[model samples]
Target: MAYVDGFVIPVKVGDRQAFIDHARQMDAIMIEEGALRIVECWADDVPEGKQTDFHRSVDRQEGETVCFSWIEWPDKATRDAAFARMGQNEVMMKTPMPFDGKRMIFGGFEPIVLLEKANG
Candidate 1:
């Protein structure tokens, strides 16, 4: 089964390009470190909810946009090992995040099922 690490971050609207640039660098590093793939999604149609929502979960403020991202790994063991390695990498440790780290939400997931459409 594939292991995944997902993230939701609130980034200033004006910093969108900067965030993308940052992600590109980070993605390259993760790929080099054994991540199968890196995906980054900018919220396009995220809706506000009365109870709880992506915006509320991240305590999003005006002039900010929500970003959804994930890293896919071959397995849990691989993911764990890569994370440990990343912690020790100087570039990974020193790179500045474009968004507020305190407000970001992230977790590792064990996928129960994954389906993909066949390509013709």
Candidate 2:
């Protein structure tokens, strides 16, 4: 089973490239620290909801876009240990985030079900 850390963030439209560059730097650190894989996705068809939605969830502003990302680890223990080691990691501490950290939403999840097709 994999332990996953998920994030939804609000980034300024003008900072898309900056965010990708930043993710590349930070994601490498996570991989070195033990993350099995990481994925960063930009919004394409997110629709506004009458009551609530991804945009509202992160308080996304008029010129911002929502990004969904995740880090996968072999297990919770590995994830926890890796994060612990990254506390005060020099590169992580120095890399600047292109989004508003205050509006980011993140959580750790234990998958309840997963299905995958075998690759040819």
Candidate 3:
């Protein structure tokens, strides 16, 4: 029963290198803040429907693709405490953000089931 912070954001097209750099910085901050693991992903194969049909999201003047990322914390309390320090985190404050954070969709998820942790 760990805590998970999930997010889906839009990055500038053709800026893969910059995105990776940004993630590297973000990784450190998350780890320092007690994150167990961070998983960042780009929309390799988005399912067809409202997702691919997103209207006026972060971008997609003519319907572009998207990416997602998440961080795993020991528990909800840890996650909450860590996020509370975001305003004062030096790395979080110094790192350059490529996308508009306001436009991103993010939140905490209570996993109904985690298979990886289940198998002994």
Candidate 4:
């Protein structure tokens, strides 16, 4: 089964382009490291939902939405290897990223059940 790396982050209102620039720079690095696909990315506006809602669990506010992204790999081992490589990259090593890294959350996500993959 393919492995997926998921990321979720809150961006202050009106900073979408800055994040995109960062992603563009990181895309090549991620691909070389083992990402088969740099999947979906989203910059959204808040909708009606509970403060503790699963999607918004880590977010708390009315104005702040999320920047979400996913990277696909062949399997977990490949993903792990990519991460290890990323750890050594100078770009990744630099702390206090140009973009806000704290509000930016990321992880290697294992799909428990992909009920319906098709979406229009």
Whichever of 2 and 4 has more TM-score, that candidate is 2
TM-score of each: 0.96, 0.96, 0.81, 0.74
For residues 1-120, write the lDDT of model 2, one tens digit per residue.
589999999999999999999999999999998999999999999999999999999999999999999998999999999889898698887777899999999999998898899999
Measured by TM-score, how close is model 4 to the native structure? 0.74
For model 4, how big is the CA root-mean-square deviation? 3.6
Better-scoring candidate (TM-score), 3 or 4: 3
lDDT of each: 0.93, 0.94, 0.76, 0.69
Native-to-model Cα distance after best TM-score fit, residue 25 in candidate 2, in Å: 0.3
Worst 10 residues of 2 by lDDT: 87-96
Rank candidates, lDDT, best first: 2, 1, 3, 4
Candidate 3 runs further than 4 Å off: 48-59, 62-64, 117-120
lDDT of 1 by residue, 18-92 (tens): 999999998998888889989999999999999999999999999999999999999989989989999998888
- Model 1's number of clashes is 0
Error of 3 at 6 (Å): 0.6
Task: Return the top candidate by lDDT.
Answer: 2
lDDT of 4 by residue, 15-100 (tens): 56766677777887888887888854655554646545424644534555566778988899998888888989898677334345
Query: Worst 10-residue stretch by lDDT in candidate 4?
Result: 52-61
Q: Residue 102 error for model 3, in Å?
A: 2.0
Tens-place lDDT digits, model 3, residues 12-115? 66666777789988888878889999988867775646645432455543333566889989999998998889778877888778766767778899787887
